[model samples]
Target chain A: MQKVVRMDDMNGVASGFPKTAGAQAVVEITDLSLVYQTADHPVTALANVNLTINKGDFVSFIGPSGCGKTTLMRVVADLEHPTAGTALVNGGSPEQARRDRAYGYVFQAPTLYPWRSVARNVMLPLEIMGLPKADQRERARAALELVGLTGFERKYPWQLSGGMQQRVSIARALSFDPDLLLMDEPFGALDEITRDRLNDELLSLWKKTHKTVIFVTHSISEAVYLSTKIVIMSARPGRIIDIIDSPLPRDRSAETRDSQAFLDVAHRVRQGLLAGHGKDD
Target chain B: MARMIRPPAILTRALPLLFVLAVLAVAWLGGAVWLNAPQIIDRWQRDGKTDYSTGELVTAAWSQERPLLPAPQQIYADLAKSFSGRLDSPRNLLFHTWVTGSAMASGFGLGVLLGGILALGIVHVRTLEKSLMPWVIASQTVPILAIAPMIVVVLGNIGLTGLLPKAVIAMYLCFFPITIGLVKGLRSPDPLQLDLMRTYSASPIQLFWKLRWPAAMPFLFTSLKVAISIALVGAIVGELPTGAQAGLGARLLAGSYYGQTIQIWSALVVSAVLGMGLVGLIGLVERITLRYQAVPKAAGGRG
Candidate 1:
């Protein structure tokens, strides 16, 4: 099952591939399939997946619980491997890209080390990169400040609320300033109000940094609100069913969420998700 | 809200003190009845003209007419006698026997350090954990009494006398609790926390020191409390096998041999006091260390 979508399918889909339109792709995945060999049996997770993500696109993977969206995100982060696939990041293997610090991964939960304060947690990647002490400190503070966590440097993880902790995790992700930010349900656990606030903050951050983002979420509203392109995946043996181009404007604000265009795109994404459900059956 | 709730100064401030006083009163009353204070006092009056004086009651306990137990007054007097060196002038009881204390101190220190290092290794290396965890559990199964003589004899033959015999014994007893508590502590990091550290790209050493080690503090203190008491037991046990001179263990031995029940009882009290002090010290350090980690705006921010 080598399902592939040509470039025509992604036309005007907000990939912004013009930076190196003629050059080699940043991430090129083909014929990706995954199966985990459990004691009971091999569980087929993903099958016949093919996609190309350019350097600075805001892409959202929207699917149900068993759709393998997170698995795909993990695969891209080099945290998990597909059973059969040709997956590459930045013209290199996923592991090589991970080693070269080309991607920053944010998990569903804000897995901040409770013992380390916010700033220290952010400085961790910098330390691994062997950056100087002063540079680590400056970059950490800058990242924290960018996430609106400026005065919380010395605060431990437990000291913050769930939203604050997630913000800290985002700050830590941004600390290294990687080209690709792989987020797996980063705001899925938060309340609706906090999620909306974080969405705005994320869009502003994304606009400023222009880093490639691959976000996995089960929330339709979140995908519609945040993504330039939304990839809807079918459940069980997950594969992309539809890649919807959101017609909402890029200069988003609170009022933009209430706009008719935003609701129309959200409705379209929901329809795509419903179509995916039919495909699964 | 003002009428329903009392002032913080009046309520929160005085509540704990009142609670503590109530608990102490209950304990004192219970102890008085359980000890049969009136009967003990009558016996003391009756035996007031006997060999042991009223002062001896403080350090050495008495059993009225019986010899099974010493009275509280008798034990108190013995404490004075032991410290005053009046029993045998030149060779004072507590002073000449300070060796036992040094032995216990050295043994406890060595045990804590060794146990701490071993815990780190076991927590990190799965193979070491599989091999060593069983032996740790097995070590506790061997009765200290059954092994004490063998250890003493072996050390004596190797010309390793003095604190070595006792320190080894203390370490044997102390390490198990430390290892068990520390393993749990090191493993206490939530999955979310571990993922965070991984995301930060923290090295193994950094992870241990910054995350696992600090997280293990409360557990460490709990085990240290148990281990310190066991260390004292080990020190005393070390004294028993050799029939050594100086130390509370030796004091217990000598007292039992001469049927000086008061002497043995007083030495036991001293050991208990020492053990309590060590546990208290660990608790104090725990409080200080945990204070810095405490979330200030948390419900109970009194740390």
Candidate 2:
């Protein structure tokens, strides 16, 4: 079913962001590696990962478990430090971009404050940013409307279903509208039907705002279905294995899934994942 | 099919309570007969009275000037009389209750505030939680009643008299639970939310006011309920050894010195009411504040 696409989606999300994110690179990483120091042993979460995400790109990072897709997103979001090489967001260090509020991150879990209503959850970032109460309320309403949750603004997070709670978190991430949007397996926990529906809504959102999105997922079909560009990573000393350029049309749908070109990209992703698992054994 | 023979809902609840009250009344009467019987018999023989029956002896046991255990009605009558009299009357339990209530409320208020401050420190600083939590718990282990005289004496010497001294004792009793509950509550936010806060690059104070503090509300109220009850106990204990002036504790002391068992019982009942009122007040506030977040499900797990 076609979800209602709002005229002004995620009002706060695009406020100060470059409208078209269409010129130059939004994210640039070169030979990036991360080593997590544990007491027993140092484990490499990501190694020698190189990529460039342009403005308005919907890039999906797909790999087997233990691959550093999440770690890469965290690097871009400035949540974790890389051990080697350089990662730049909006042409500056990740720390600098984070301070600039250049990006918003959505975790795998909904991460909505249970005590807060849906609108209040969306208002959290704006509250931290010290926006006026009136502006915060306005932006929250617009963001919730973008996610088709206008009527449920006053409902607490627990009162909503899992999918609705996830949408609320999406509204929250976009409440402050940043140039970059990082999602780490946001729909991984949802059932197939809900996931498909959300995938369509997300694509429509991306289409509307043209925000630079870095989505991480395990499903091959999901990556092929949503991404303009697909990044495949390998496990065990996690490293970028291949970068596949998706030939799927911009408006990829159920028909796109049955299309030969879409199947070609999905098969390639599956093979890339199988190769990563092969190295594991 | 035959319909189920379920009792009416009101009857189902009230019947059990009525039965329990009946059993307690019967046991209390039997105890009165057993203990007061000796005295009534002694008087009968001493007066050379003749033809005293079991029924006469039972009726005689009911109205002693100072019975070993006063009947429930005797205590109730004393409470009614004490409550009905003038506000300034020394015999009035309600006035004594107010004297205690002032100290309890003040101490409870101060304790909750201090505990919240200490909890904020404990939650933010890792070393503080390790260093201070042990001491906070240890302070409770040293019974407040045992230390009440010392606190009152030291404060009294320093010119901290009356309500202030009793309030200090209440604070000593009240703060531990608030501190512990708040610490647990402040740290209760899911790790994912913490990471989200980090992503926002939110300042420590911002994080506290928005995330940590609000999340800690339910736990704070729960702890406050417990603390308020104990705070009343602390107020009474503070009054026990200090000057014996104008509190339920003082009333109890006066009654004990003058051999007024009925007076002591009335004081005890009034204090119980005060504790319940304080806890009920907290519960009402909790309901009002947390009204939005109530989910209709039984909490299936502890912690």
Task: Give me the candidate number with maximum lDDT.
Answer: 2
Q: lDDT tens digits, residues A111-202, model 1? A: 77665788998987888778999999999999999999999998788878999999998998999999899898999899999999999999
- lDDT score, residue A189, model 2? 96
Show where candidate 1 strays beyond 4 Å: A1-24, A278-281, B1-74, B84-97, B196-203, B295-303
Q: Which ten residues in a row have the lowest lDDT in candidate 1 chain B?
A: B58-67
Model 1 lDDT vs. the true structure?
Answer: 0.80
lDDT of the structure predicted as candidate 2: 0.87
What is the C-alpha lDDT profile of model 2 across A1-281, one tens digit per residue? Answer: 01111211221132223223334678878768999999999999998776777788899999888888998999998888999878878878999998888899999999998878888999999999999999999999999999999999888887899999999999999999997899999999999999999999999999888898999999988899999889899888998877776777787667888999998988888887888788878
lDDT of 1 by residue, B1-303 (tens): 467765686688899999998897666444534454455556767977455544454333333433455555567776776577654442456653466667777888888888888898898888999998888889899999999999999999989987889989988899888988998999998865675555455678877876788888888889988988898899889988886576788888888898776677778888888888888988888778776556656547454
- Top TM-score: which candidate number? 2
Candidate lDDT values, in order: 0.80, 0.87
